[model samples]
Target: MIDSFETDEDIVVVTEFVDKQLYALINSEGPMPEELVRQITCDLVSALFYLHSNRVLHRDLKPQNILIDALGKAKLCDFGFARHMGRGTMLLTSIKGTPLYMAPELIKESPYDHNADLWSLGCIVYELLVGVPPFKTSNFASQDCISFLQGLLQKDPRERLTWPDLIYHPFLKGDVLVQQDLAASLPPLTEPLSDSQQLFKETQRQILLDRQPRGSKLTKFVDYFKQKISLEEGNVKTVDGEPMQISPSTTPTPDNPANSNSQRVHTSKSREKKKSKSFEPKSQTEESESDEENQVQNYEWLDYLHRSMEEVFNHDLSCVFKPPLVKVATSPLLKRNFSPQVYNSVACLLILPFITEDRNSTRLKTLLESYAESNVVDLLVQGMWTLLAKKKSELDEFDLVKSKQLSSERLLAIENIILLLSYLVYKQPYPKVDIFLNQFCNAVKSRGSSFALVTRHLLTLSKRRPKIVSDILSIYNHIIRILPSQSLVVLEAVIGNSATKAKEKKQIDLGKFLDSPNAMLRLNTCVLIRYLTRKFGASPYKYWDDSIKQKLVRNAKEDTDLKANVAAGLAVEVIKKLELITSA
Candidate 1:
């Protein structure tokens, strides 16, 4: 689509005009044929691979950002949210994107990578196939495309489809040779090959080379769990009508599992075990080699399971219920693997919060302990919690007025932290419930407007996830059970929040509840004011409007409920105590 470039004024690069946006095309053209959608998905993903390989991330990926020419060819446009993200660099914390197309990792405010684009790709594919994004529409039906769609929509990016997996999957591989041939023929046309198309063909060529057997192959992995792989050991399979090196012995008879009997190859340790029952002492070198082999096998097995989660079982809600799935989320030992750890740890935390049953909780806890040997739990908690603290501090320094107009990264970060904390408090409280709450309250103290926005965020969450919020709210309300001891910590936070809001002079719509007719509203409002007095003592007299202060004081003093009266009286005592201390 590139026409020419003008770098003189603002480096404006011109491109051929595309008559329509992808969103409009989908709406006007009805649902596309599944096969056609598959080809589109391939081209789009191939484009993404090129962009990602070049160290760029198209942060905002939605149907609106995609353009369709009269020939129905798609071009990814809009680089406003695009940024160059080098290898091992921190995940883009400066979030900017449409919400519906965002990956769950981004939604949870976890550090994410290029695979985030795959998640959005999944959304686009779903929209094309169903005329709406997955789960958003009841109009779509489940058919041949469901499995391919599920993998891309996976919440865990580590478990989501990667470039290699996308190219090899059945959907894109419907006629593998044909698709590759089509991909290859693009370069010869009068049109200059797009960066995306060229890069995609290049990837396919590299993949084809890698897939070729070298000198009859030395090692054959037993894909024991998922034998549906097209490749088979020692099997003679026709590849586009040409015989391959694979022999009849290694051919898979997956459809006839009962009749499929073959010699099971044993791993080194198993092979060693077959030799003798007696324990034989070995040299240190032998022991180290055995250990190394076992480690390699373990990692390979984990990788296989990661693929199986996406390919075989499919990433459904049921995946979250499986206890053993924690291994996918557990952080690796090496520090350089922190990005995966952050993603996995966040997944684990999100999973834990939703487990309400005792049996499920115990099952999940045991699985987590088994996977990471219980070492990473506290570390994971501390790491994510710390990132959240840092995000809040960053939000504090950014201009609130301008920041408000941008994406809500800070809002998502805080809500995720609170929900994770709430879950931790409910599920695994290694930091101790009271201690963790204190840390959270303290985190909120310096957060400035971030704290003020939390009330609004929670209100929004309450609407969207009422059942989940109801449960989370109970854990939060439990802080009141420890009242006057560490209970005032939350109250202090509320004071800080109200103070920040007052200073900003921005009125949240929800904040209007004070003057509402609802008794519950009036009671909660009065309760907040009572706590404000306790924090300020007599200082509210100076800082607050006289009319407002008097109204709050009178409400607390004259409220009919005895509980309300007592809360109101505490403010007076705080004032008297401050006066006595001053007189001394």
Candidate 2:
């Protein structure tokens, strides 16, 4: 027995090399003469009979496994999973066959004999006759194969036909039987007919022609078939059973200019007809209605886009300029106090280009230049500082004012604006960086409670532009000097924030505040110094000086409230920083 590996799961019995399979030949060239299908089916049945007589059950019989030699003789192969049955014993096990052609008994996992093979044969014959399988259903489990078996093959095994009886089944008993006899008596099945087929044959010929290597015999065969078909007269029938007419005036002839010209004209007309058939046009009234619907949808989308753009801009501006409480309280009289609406409008103006398609890049650049000239950065910075101061005053008098009027919302808005602007600056180099920095420095110096907000903005800026560290350090130094003793905690927070950078650690000198009379000042100074040491590999002793450390230790032991708490926290931070620095 010849053997060949078929797939990862099984092997196939090797047979004589065949040019093609009978199923593929029929499928590609359309339904063959019924006689040809019968002849092929007879050969398949004979092979199945022989295999069964030898005690081998072809459990997985399918069209692909049935090989057709060049002589048109069918052979059964691929018996990798075939089971052997001793005399008088039937093989009945798990269901295994192609789903569409499987026997009802097999699908139900019932004990079955060779009758299952006959059921599959009926399915194949039905497919050849109808160009599709019988009993097509979406629900595989619901398909009652028993009904098909009973009607097509007779339910009882004894009643079902043997191989001899199947060949004479009513469906295959007419003109097909005569044609089968003729095919069987003829010489070997020649290479499939080329001229008397559909356009698919011509396409296949062309593909095969192209795939052949240079100077191959297949090229000669392709040319021979192409010439024969090109010269043949039309005989095929249309679906309506009328003869398809080929106009002699438009017929293509080999190597004739007149024929070529006429052929092109005929092709062009055929294409025009096809185009007209596919083309569709709505009535004027219908078109007008569609246009109106589209216009409404477009307007809705535009409106939503505008609102989203406005929201993004407003959020960003709030970070730059949060309104002050004093200004909020006196707004009724002055009517000039900044509000969320005003900030939103200003932000929209800044980012309007992103939302508007009609606005050109040059026009946007001009708009940005105009805003830069008006010192918009300074206005935004001042607004943020004013808003922070108002929030602090309101917090101090929380009982006097209703909770709804709290400035946290305004503070958050201003923070958003600062972040937005910071992002814009990083993405694109704004020509007015100096103006923005000067205004930001002034704001940081004036509002002590706004240090956290200012520090965060500076942190973002530092990440974007490391070269601006000196400028940021200058602003930090100025803020530390002017901030009140009570606000030293804010200063300490800002200093601790700056300690994120290894280089910025040296810029802050916390030891200078060690001698301050305010216990909070000394406590914050120790905290900040310890943080810098840990973050930047700086020595805690160097940052606080030995005397300052002693003072902080003494304060932790004496003062019980804020001062002691701050000192104790600083002590822990100092040891952690020391360990990190030493490890580094």
Best by lDDT: 1
Per-model lDDT: 0.45, 0.42
- Model 2 earns a TM-score of 0.26
Best by TM-score: 1
Off by over 4 Å in 2: 1-14, 135-152, 155-158, 167-584
Measured by TM-score, how close is model 1 to the native structure? 0.34
TM-scores of all candidate predictions against the true structure: 0.34, 0.26
Q: In model 1, which runs have C-alpha deviations exceeding 4 angstroms?
A: 1-76, 79-396, 399-417, 423-477, 485-488, 497-584
**Model 2 lDDT-worst window of ten:** 278-287
What does the lDDT come to for candidate 1?
A: 0.45
